[model samples]
Target: MSNSQQQYPFYFKSTIILFGISLVCYALFVLSDILAPIAFSLVIAILLNPMVTKLQKRGVNKIVAISLAIGLAFLIVAGIIYFITNQIVNFGDNLPQLKLKFNENLANVQQWLNTHLNITIAKQQKLANEALNSSQALLGRTVGGALGILSLIFLIPIYVFLLLYYKTLIINFFHEVFAEENSAKVSEVLGATKAAIQSYMVGLLLEALVVAVLNSVALMIIGLDYAILIGVIGALLNMLPYIGGIIAIALPVILASVTKDGYSTQLAVVISYIVIQFVDNNFLVPFLVSSRVKINAFFSVLVVLLGGALWGISGMFLSIPFVAILKIIFDRLPEMKPWGKLLGDEVPTRHKGEIWQRKRLRQEASNPEKEKSL
Candidate 1:
């Protein structure tokens, strides 16, 4: 058969691809406890690579440069942790007052429901008791989750150091696997992935800072207690794509309802968040985070939801970068370019024929003869 005329079995190929994807997903889910920390470490190591390179160019030893970069990153993280811990400590002091306000609101709600909806306070208490039981179980799971987080905190740094130290071996392994046939393409993909990730990570941090400031300022203007703390938290959660934004909004709204009298202040908080979200989605994301990663919003949200389903929050956070790396690789390979386009944000350009076709279709309502002839 001529090369151009060669035919492949579409169904078989698709089946194989589907099976491979399923197997990989299963493995990822099963080994998530082991893999998630490693994945995070690799991303952080990639982010720190430029610093290591710059230090090495200045005659710093490779090992020393890596150590210095890691140390600097550690100190910055520690400082942030300390600051947030202090905030939490201060926030704890208001718990009693918060509880009192919450109880008062709950009573008012019960009274309103009794008057308007004809629901009794006894029925509401029964429902609340059922919810409290479920919440207690949730609290236990949360405690276990905290311990897991602590373990990851200890493990990730070591993984990052090892990954950085063996970075040369990792690069060489890719070249060896691809061999000479596609060595150049592999190198290009690697470089592009690294640059995209580096820029995206740095830009993500900057964007989060801007969002935190905006949130804090809005809350402070409305005189919300613990505004700075809640704002910082919301900004951090907003890093996790679609779902985080919902949770971020809920926290302040709940606080507003509990602490403030009447619903006007709560309404203001919601309005403020809606405006901030509009600014964030339209302006901040395009300029900072989305500039490097070109995945379209539909797939971005889909992958995030899929990632969360498969590997929980770590997967949600990791999904975009993973998809971006895939896109870069896909676009380079001739057969995979279509797949790259599927994930990419680029809109398909309209040709003259398409526009002309639409114009004809619109005119066809008055031209039954022309439509029948066609």
Candidate 2:
């Protein structure tokens, strides 16, 4: 076959592959309510597997080991929920006074704006009231979906338990998908994936703990109320990547402005968060999360945005691990190796000087008589 004829099939195959990916993405978006918990549970299941294996090696039964793993996971989650709930309740008790203080601050802001910008306080108040109403309506709609939240809370653990229980079968299914000759490669990939994901989970938890402690201590020193609660909430939200940090900074700073003495305290809170974010993005992530995931910053942000668009917050949280797993798969297959390179963090240094090198060699090859004379 001629070169063009041979290339036609390659182009057709590429188009088909692209179409397939698009279809899969659409299906995932449509089925997010079902898939989100399953995806989350899969990550938890992977994290818990090593513990289960250790228990089994110590003479524990598989069922007992699985139960212990699930129990530990549930307890950890429950403790966090209880602590946050208690803090929220305590904060609620002071809500009325906080509301009055907030109104005073708003009036001061409005008066300042009116004086400086010639904007009437009445107009500002009208806009504020409209915004408040819209926020309340949004909150009402969110609260109306409590059942879905409850279902996810209930189903996630159950899914984790079942997934852990049947992990061997899942592994077997994965192996069977490939040819017999590729079994060793398949096993290697599976092992690498487990190790990477487990390390990522552990690192993420440690990072959260470190961040929460730092934030709480900083806020406490600055005399911010509910320092621990705000710190912990911010730390947890920070797990969601770019968007989370902005929300984290806004939450405590807004509260500090109302509760604290002056704008100085609010500025301190903002500065503290900036420092925390700097430490996190520069140090903690590189040392902890990045070592495990190895995803480029560009692809990481893109995946998070796409996830949020398709499945909201849960998707954003899960997207990194999901893409990491995909990268692992792509790396193992020769046909997908280019994709693996694209997803990786490192730029290809070898390719930087390749074009000039090829041109020089091609010119030399065409000038054989001149080279011989020299």
| Model 2 Cα RMSD, 1 decimal | 4.0
State every prediction's TM-score relative to the real structure.
0.83, 0.85
lDDT of each: 0.86, 0.85
Best by TM-score: 2
State in Å the error of residue 245, model 2.
Answer: 2.0
Predicted candidate 1, C-alpha RMSD: 5.5
- Segments in model 1 whose C-alpha atoms lie over 4 Å from true places: 1-9, 107-151, 349-374
lDDT of 1 at 223: 95
List clash counts for every candidate, in order: 0, 0
